[model samples]
Target: MSFEVDIGYASARGPREDNEDFAAVVRPAPHDEARGLIAAVADGVSSGGQGRLAAQTTVMSLVQDFHGVPETWDTTVALDRLISAQNAWLAGHNRRRSGEGTAMCTLTALVLRGHSYTLAHVGDTRAWLLRGGECIQLSQDHSFDHPDLRHALSRAIGLDDHVRVDYSQGELHRGDVFVLTTDGVHGVLRRRELAARAREGSAQAASEALVEAALKAGSRDNATALVIRVAGLAAGRLEDLLLRGRQLPVPPKLRVGDLLDGYVITAMLADNGVHRLYQARSVATQALVAIKALHEARASDPQERAMLAHEAWLGSRVARDGQAGLVRVHELEDPSAFYVVYDWHSGQTLEQLIEDGRRLDVSEVVDAGRAVLKPLGRLHRQGVIHRDIKPANLHRGDDGQWRLLDLGVAVSGREPEAARSLHAGTPSYINPEQWQPDDPVRADAGSDLYALGVTLYQALTGRLPYGEIEPYQLARFRRDPRAPSQVRPDVPIWLDHVLLKAVARDPKLRFETAEEFALALERGASRPLPAHGSTPLVARDPAVLWKIALVVSLLFNALLIVWLLFLPR
Candidate 1:
């Protein structure tokens, strides 16, 4: 099955001299099926002189420019960029015609991609969804209630230098009806009436009926309604995600001066058994980039191929400033092989810095922790967890900026249940709960926090908090490990306390959020530190206590045997 939609739109001048409302639906071409369908409606501010122009320009730009966005970009990201650009253009146009008047409008757009629909809105133009005979508003009005003016827009395009658009996304299902309308239509019609009319007939009939009903109800402004019914939904497939990567052949081994597509390899950056990283320069752009390719042997494995593709896909979803951005895949010319390309930065791995015995100042350490945690926070907010967070996976740029890298094992909120149990992170860095045999290991914000604490501790002193935990070893956490202060006397007392609390044996004891942890490091510990040696020996070192018990048992047995012999038993 494939995505199919029935779309209809209607606009009327009502009592107004001219219609200031615009609406349209643009269906993707056969080759652009992945881009899916776009429907939008815009309402121009009646008081504005160029209301008609603003409304028409806003809707037209959204439907046309949306297609120009890179196919690899997430729908929300693409829509946001397009909307922002349109806003800038409209604002500039208004400034140029400042003597005449300014143009302003409210826009609401819905993009149906894959099995989901993303809603982008600004101003008072509204978006609604009708399912199971119920109508629900999907977009919030940017207007406010004023005593003098019944309804005044608080936000709108072309009204300011910056526009803040609201966005939301939800799964799509067959038979779902989406409605877009200007305030004139929705303000006059009741929710119950709107739902009933929208569900009664074909999309075109429904749209017309809704607008007529609004006019009959005495609407004084221009009325517009756009209706979209999901006729069918495509069954999700892996190929949809893998896309080009699935069709391309795995890249072969490369040496210096070897070329693939437009990139020429300069040197081998890393060569782990599973994959290889090469430092290369694009012949076309003359820009440096890092290309990662799976080893030929592992390329045949479907799981490995998916992981590599997913890493690139996930990298593209994150904002560049938040994580190491992926080079635009669409820019690469037709290639003989598949590989992921990343923008190269001159930097040293945190692991290498630690291994080199570079002394880090307290301020430097705190700054690094804050920098790394910021991206991790962004990932968490996006419902992504970086299962594998370690010093080796973090880079300290020559510009003194730290960025988190390697999304190969990152788990998203939409990940399947079976995939959640798969062990994907470093054994030493994984939290205790993740290693429990009976407990299901799922990546969450707390898990990332645990790893962040471990990372901070290792950076401060080149040592693991729980030592090197082997993959086969069953991890057990009975007590806290040695504090950072114990290893480095120069470590501040409060900072040590903060780190200890972060990597606490219990997830509940750890800082609840990355922001909290960053704040603790930025400003000294908010709470008092526990006294040293507060924990008992049995809890702190169970292995040592067990050894002592074994020795005592042997001595007692030896004495018992001597007594038995002397008593003539």
Candidate 2:
């Protein structure tokens, strides 16, 4: 069963002249069923003369227009946008007819897509979830607590030009039950009573019993109730949640025995001053996973947290697209702290191999280059630039496959400013263009190729092309590096040419795409690339003119001495 559910709802005017309450469940055509089911209930504010219109229009717009929203939108974003638009229209209409009743209502909307549920709430409308024998309130009532203001709502649709709707989301289970109700039904009935009624029979019976019970309790207002019971959940796309505020709290620095969302930390992987890595194993499946979290000191910084969030999103995106060169990002379903999970692969990084004095021959260098560049090419095609691609960030798994690591600084265009604006990358491996005076931190395909070239060069010759560059230092690319063959005599001629072209001082001279550079390596000496000649002496040696001038003067003086000694003086 794919996302099967049972929905039932009931509404009545009770003692009022007519019901100003609305309840609906919208399911799209079978072909477009991935939009999922939308269940909502609204209570019109009596003070707003157009309360009925507000309640009806708000819920109707969402159910009717939701499927038409762009497919790229996350479920929460789509619902929030639709709700906000309806509020604006109601507010504008009220202003145009100032002497009449305003259109305002309290709303609670629920969207069940894939294996999760997203909610939008305002005013006193409520959403409840019954799971594991506990009935939990999923939405807060946006009303005042004072006796006189008890019925007064602090927030409602069309109450103001700007409406702040509370949005929430969580994992859905097979036997979970969800209920939506207007204030009329909830004000008179307690959670125990509601749960008891909701569990007595089928969803239809539960919905009818809640409304009838509320009315029998002497409620003066209209009563409404909508109930949904999940029978199954469907696997779906990764739904993105905005991490602006109310994100999970950052966990404190943990110990070996520490656990997060059922993952037990077995050992600490690394502890940079800003981020911490831990090796953990899932208690349920016993599968190993690596956890990345903000250091306790940096947990307070929002920018760092956003960067980590973006990294996780990017990693998941890459993994979902079936890019084998990246470590798989695992979803926690629900988590206790703000941390990222990745498949833990026991491996040594290329940097580690080099540090152990292991030198890679031409064949190994080519293999590594192709391994890193193939998926890198795919990532670039997807408009993502792996900003940091040094040897340390390239791990060679025990299975002998190389995987790119650390997308914390990747520029994916969809990421926040902190992920893109931050000048990030290993200085030694960064391309010359990234250090430009006019557009420093600029990155593109060529820059990635340049970094790959540097890594391959270092792996082949055990030395950086332009030598070691410290971070934050302005790197000069005026000097050309010696060919890889100069440092390692066994370096092949074809690879030497490719390295020089990849790390060329001018960006224009380097390979423009991973495919082009890859072709050069693939062809090898059989189809060696044409040499572009050496850098002009003036560019390679800025003091060449001065040296020439000094030499000329010395020669002229020596000739004068010889003439004076040989001829009459």
Candidate 2, superposed: residue stretches over 4 Å from native: 1-6, 12-19, 26-38, 44-52, 66-104, 111-124, 129-177, 199-205, 215-221, 229-246, 255-258, 438-441, 471-476, 538-569
Provide TM-scores for the models.
0.56, 0.81
Deviation from native of the Cα of residue 110 in model 2, angstroms: 4.0
The CA-based lDDT of model 2 is what? Answer: 0.83
Off by over 4 Å in 1: 1-35, 38-241, 321-336, 414-419, 472-479, 525-565
What does candidate 2's lDDT look like per residue over 378-420, in tens digits?
A: 8899999998889999999999999999888898877777767
How high is the lDDT of residue 228 in model 2? 95
Q: Score each candidate by Cα lDDT.
A: 0.80, 0.83
Candidate 1's error at 43, in angstroms? 37
